[model samples]
Target: MARTVTPEIVAHVKRFEGCKLFAYPDPGSVNGEPWTIGYGHTSDSFLKVRKGMTITQAQADAALEHDLNEVADAVERLVKVHLTDNQFGALVSFAFNVGNKAFANSSLLKKLNAGNYDAVPAELARWNKNDGKVMKGLTNRRAAEAGLWAKGSFVASNTVEAAPGNPIKDLTKPETITAAGGLLSGAAALATGSPAIQIAVGICLVVAVGVIAFLVIRKATR
Candidate 1:
């Protein structure tokens, strides 16, 4: 399968690039040119980003999705070597942080393409510096990238599994939805006095039914 960024890599990037609802000056920007928002995204990543602009949580998430896709596409286009999902994710995160141009021109890319795969982690580590100075955050990020490069592939990110005998469970699970829906329906049946309460209960029942149907469809497709 073609390699792509995994949720592990997304979580890694998000750990460092915190979300900001309001646009703020890019601290790493030497010239104060681009304002940033929503998990290190700038106007280049999302055109709507500008000074004095605010965004909803959904918009921020959308911007992150857009930016990650752009970076992943760029990584796929530029790199010639075959990469595992983890490797691709690591490079995508690096490229997203350092920009495509820098990544394209870096020795890491050169060494990677030339078949010196062992040099990847070291070369990636060398990129810890920003504007000739080493930033602690950058150092930490590079270390994480190095680890990612070395680590091999694992299971798919969206695989939702519950541990044995766990009390807390995922709400989307079929059993959970069925149980919740049964309780809601019983409560609705018992509340014969208030029409308003029944309406609310009806809405809840509809939502629960929709959830159960969705789970069934998802399972069948899988």
Candidate 2:
């Protein structure tokens, strides 16, 4: 059976890759390296990415889906053992970040296929260096990926907690207030017996709340 990459996996990859609608060179390069666009899709023989190329959010999303499918296919082809959804997702995200070729040749894959599961995390962490130097972002990403692989869930550790002197008491900011209003409005509409309208409104409100909360937390940490 061919395993499918779940939506959760797609979300995880997107969170790390981020959305760059316009083409930009890799950051660590002195000269403009491979141009990347639309959720870390780099220019290759298969796709021609140019300097001024820009895409809409929908187009970017489509590109991400296509790229992720390719990575998922590669993961399915390479791994020998059965995997959980989270483990599959972690590998997909890793392969997406570090190219399919590197993933195929990695010690992580070797150990995973050889049934040395206990050694996988250390093997995954060994690839945290960029240009032969360790990067903090890469270190965190590897840890998260390894955690997902081992535990079969994404554990969020990115949030900034309250310090000794300062406290973060008010989570009901304007955006959250708007989200609450939306939730209430959806509930009211549901009470009116419009099932379709209520479902749509509820989904929109939930998405809104999620987006608002993510933005607020991200901004606070920064």
Candidate 3:
């Protein structure tokens, strides 16, 4: 819990593999509006703020980032209080999608408190509905969250906290590695159930093979 919240976490959460971070009316404009909340950027939606709120995009972005930091902090606290590492990450991922309240009232929370790990996966599936509809996005998120949540137990030492002697250490700054790693992990999770990931991975594999072949041919000529 010594790691503080940093811009890393903000960027990680704000990162949209196939979604837009801004609010607009057209799906073609930004990978479609979010399944639950349509309008504005993903970041704006995350903060539950309205577009055209009299702030510059930059200012609005800052506010949204700050709100995410707040959410992350809240997640850390909840993790400390009850959930395990995987559970914490899962909850964060869930919050990133369904917003915080869903996690707050989630049966996952209840099950976790009762030390019922087996119940988490099922509870996660129940969160896939929005406004009386079964949204595909929510379904994907729930599955990803279930996977992440199943990772391990609560290990607060992995959390960012202040130095024992340094009270000035801010809790709002996420560590660089944690932020970057979390973003990459999120991408991996999204990619697992998304065609986009397969496409990207294929592209990368192809590029790697090409580079290796080029190197091999050059060595033979030498």
Candidate 4:
């Protein structure tokens, strides 16, 4: 049976790609670049994206649905192994971001086909760089994809083991970082025993905590 892309996967792609109602040039492209509209829908789409073109949010959403369906179909055709919804969704998101050709040719796909599922996350993270620079957003997106890819398992759960230096283990969740920072700040304040230094550290910690809270709220609302 052909697998389908889930709504959760669609939302993940949308959150990362972001919706632009009006057509815009690819950020990394030079002049005369192919225009992208909707949720990263490009000129290659049948929807007729062009310079100066505009679309309603409803139109964008419709375009995204169409695009994801095509990508999902491509993923289904290319992947030979049976996949869970989460794995299929992760691959679709990857193909949506990197293009079907890249996804088809990727070492990630190769490893997946070879039943080396444990190596998939590292392979996904390798694509986090663009134009020879590492992008933090892509890194985060790939990590999320890896997490989803491993969500369910007949194969991944049973066969895959965390290798030494696994990136997943190294990924520090934001909440953990916040908690650790608080502890470190408290320790520093106590160790210094200098009133001025303690006051400065306290102010910095307050600002850091406030910023973290704001970011969390913003992400939640989004």
Top candidate, metric lDDT? 4
Residue runs of model 4 more than 4 Å from their true location after superposition: 154-222
- Candidate 3 to native Cα RMSD, angstroms: 23.0
| Ranking of candidates on TM-score, top first | 4, 1, 2, 3
lDDT of 2 by residue, 144-177 (tens): 8888888743334558744432113335666567
Q: How many clashing residue pairs, candidate 3?
A: 22
Q: lDDT (0-100) at residue 194 of candidate 4? A: 86
In TM-score terms, which candidate is top?
4
**What are the per-residue Cα lDDT tens digits for candidate 4 across 60-178?**
98889889999999999988887888988998999999999999888888888888867878999899998899999999999999999888764524567633343333235676477
Q: Tell me the number of clashing residue pairs for each predicted model.
A: 0, 0, 22, 0
Off by over 4 Å in 3: 1-64, 79-85, 152-222
Question: lDDT at 179 for candidate 2?
Answer: 65
Compute the lDDT for candidate 1. Answer: 0.81
Residue pair clashes in candidate 2: none
Q: Each prediction's Cα lDDT score?
A: 0.81, 0.80, 0.56, 0.82
- Provide TM-scores for the models: 0.64, 0.64, 0.45, 0.67
RMSD of each: 15.7, 18.3, 23.0, 15.2
Better of 1 and 4 by lDDT: 4
Q: What is the lDDT of residue 47 in candidate 1?
A: 57
Query: Mind giving the per-residue lDDT tens digits that candidate 1 earns over 57-111?
Result: 8888788888898989989988999888888888998999899999999999999
